[model samples]
Target: MEDLKREGFTLVNGSLGLDLKHCQLVLRKIAGYHAASVVLHEKNPKCFNNFLDNVYSTDCLDDFGPVIRTIFKNCVDMISKWPGYGTYVDTLRSLEDTIVSHIRKANERDEAMYNVLNHGDLWINNIMFKYNEQKQEVEDVR
Candidate 1:
């Protein structure tokens, strides 16, 4: 992010080194986004529910559940090439469960917080950082 650069965030330009501090800043921003969404939902219920009902339809995933399960199962079967095969399979199973849980929770959360706009994607790549002149490393992240 240009703002981060102006602020004092130094980008390594390559994967040769880890930017721990910058990484933390990004993580914090992500957490803040999630928190903001939660707060927004608490403030507005009807709008949130309407948006969820209209936008994120469970029909999509549900209709495709068999396909997804098959893909996941195939991937799990192939993962035996790696060590701790059983552990990895267990983790994969847990991941599938988590996905289902998240979908259900998201539907409920959306209904409760229909006031704020729902962001389907709020990940690192969606955000940009910029450098600030006043800071040496990373300045402001946008």
Candidate 2:
């Protein structure tokens, strides 16, 4: 792993609401990373086959199901205590049983479609950005 901190990159924690410009910069870099991976895979088809093996398959999701549900429940509980958020809490609680399955389904790769290297667990905390001199523009990402 790269020492992003040493490179003056910083990650925005999940709880903080992300501004549109920061979000855009992060997404643009992610898209570029995905695109670059695709090109690399095309150039050396055999090199990427090892990575194509499903490390996060349905069985793996099953392993994480309880943990996922617990986190979901915690989120629901947190929101449940908040005034005027009852509707959202109810919706989240109702989906607890199926959320893991839904995620597993979405993660199922379609062989017919061209697949690139997927950043499987991407979240706000996993991305680090480096800003310009004024700290107003994101110039690099990791």
Candidate 3:
């Protein structure tokens, strides 16, 4: 792995929300990364065979059900007080039983469309940005 710090690149704090400019830069880079991955996948799908490691890809993280339920409950409690969101709260409660299956299906790689391995969990720390000399503008992202 090339040393990004030595090459003048920097990482942002994942705890804070990125500014619109940085968010745009990160999106452009992610889009480019996905586009390149699609080409690589089409040329050699075997290269992606070992990349099937997602949270919902297996039952290993099934223990997280209570966590998910609590989150949904908090969501419902927070939204139940909204003027016109009572139905939405009920809907969220109703999804507790089948949401995990939906998540599993969504996490699966769809080979029909020549699905490339996705880096969809795009957290702030997962990206690196290089700024200009004065650190005013982002020069590149990785």
Candidate 4:
């Protein structure tokens, strides 16, 4: 972390509204990380298997299923009351079951391709970027 700071990388200071370039840079960095992990797993399955054993599975969300469903229900109810948001509410309702099932199946160990390392929690706060001091361009991300 210190080395990253010394290299001009910083935690993003605040919300970046509609910043497509920055968003793309972050996505690219994440993609690279996943791709590298996939390659490593392919080349060294035993080591990768051992590494994955230490990581928590997404099945942990099973314990929060009720909470998730409640949140979605509340969101749908609130949004449904708003004018011109009926479509959004309907869409959310339509996808709710599918979303929950996907979450439940996400940690299944049968799919080797799905076992690659990934950022389980990706959000603005978890991302960091290096910026070119003079040009203000995104130099790197982690």
Instruction: Name the top lDDT candidate.
Output: 2
Answer with 3 or 4, whichever has the higher TM-score: 3
lDDT of 4 by residue, 1-142 (tens): 3577777778876655427788899888888888888788778878775555422345556667777778877888899999998878878888666666665566556653556676778887777788888999887887
Stretches off by above 4 angstroms in model 4 are 50-59, 74-85, 95-99, 106-115
Candidate 4: RMSD to truth: 3.4
Clashes by residue pair, model 2: none
lDDT of 1 at 38: 70
Best by TM-score: 3
lDDT of 2 by residue, 1-142 (tens): 7788998898766798678887787788779878998789779878986775563554877888899899988989999999999889878888999988877776676777767787877888788888887856877777
Q: lDDT score of model 1? A: 0.59
lDDT of 3 by residue, 1-142 (tens): 9999998899988778788889888878777877998999778878877785767787754877678777867877889999988877877888877776777777777767656556767787778988899857877888
Question: Which tens-of-lDDT digit does each residue in 93-138 have in candidate 1?
Answer: 6666455445555565433333344456755555455565565556
For all predicted structures, in order, the TM-scores are 0.51, 0.69, 0.75, 0.74
- Evaluation by TM-score, superior candidate among 2 and 3: 3
TM-score of 2: 0.69
Q: What is each predicted model's overall lDDT from 0 to 1?
A: 0.59, 0.80, 0.78, 0.73
